[model samples]
Target: MFSKACEYGIRAAIYIGQQSAELGRRVGLRDVAAEIDSPEAFTAKVLQQLVRAGLLTSVKGPTGGFELTAQQLATVTLRQIVVAIDGGDMLQGCALGLPQCSAQQPCPLHYQFLPIRDQLNEVLRTHTIGELAGKVHDGLGFLKQFT
Candidate 1:
């Protein structure tokens, strides 16, 4: 699982990517936050982290907004976004929250969880923002819960 900030970061990135790639427009912070159903202040902070990590670009003005280039949308994997917002520890940390869990001194669930973790890492590494956004653009995916 990801932290709240990271969750919002992923949602924000996908929304921005969708707008940029599908709508061919940059998105304002207000619009991004509204689309993701997140708080503007918190989303702003998360967006800053993505911008600092070079995952998203920001501009300031009436027409300025956030966007990812085509290259970025195509190449920026979920792993990179996760790392940028949550660090690499989520992929490597023990599922049981043991401080010293490892192969040499495995936690009770470590071995069992290893395969699951490996699979998650693989999916994150392979799934690009563009792929996810395209799903939304194509109406095959929904970012927010539907009533």
Candidate 2:
């Protein structure tokens, strides 16, 4: 239940981390967007958010691009990325987008969705980018939809 921007941000971070961890390579915006199947301009904006969050580093000129240190690549979690791009409200907001959808006067699906929301938050909070990327790298999982 994330925004498309948030989704691409997560994927881009994971792919960038994967490249550094697996290939020891730094990635440019075009390459990052290509790998993640995200739009170039949209991905650029998303990457800008990550860079602003200090979760990624970039260089401007020729032979310049983006890269993360091993620790950064390994330790940044999905939760961090989502929060960086979309804010905590994306996870903590009302499921129905209602302003007052809390337990006091719950929405129709509020109770049913609370546990699922908690589970997703925990999963994102606990799982590091490297761990998730490693799954794809090892063929235990995949990031690409069709491939």
Candidate lDDT values, in order = 0.94, 0.86
lDDT of 2 by residue, 12-72 (tens): 8888888878888789999989888999999999999999998888878887788878888
Candidate 2 ranges beyond 4 A from true positions: none
lDDT (10s digit) by residue, model 1, range 1-147? 899999999999999999999878999999999999999999999999999999998988988999999989999999999999999987999988899999999999998999999999999999999999999999999889979
Ten-residue stretch with the least lDDT total in model 1: 55-64
Runs of candidate 1 with Cα error greater than 4 angstroms are none
TM-score, predicted candidate 1 vs. hidden true structure: 0.96
Q: Among these predicted structures, which one has the highest TM-score?
A: 1
- Give the Å shift of residue 7 in candidate 2: 1.4
Q: TM-score of the candidate numbered 2?
A: 0.91
Residue pairs with colliding backbones in model 2 are none
RMSD of candidates 1 onward, in order: 1.0, 1.5
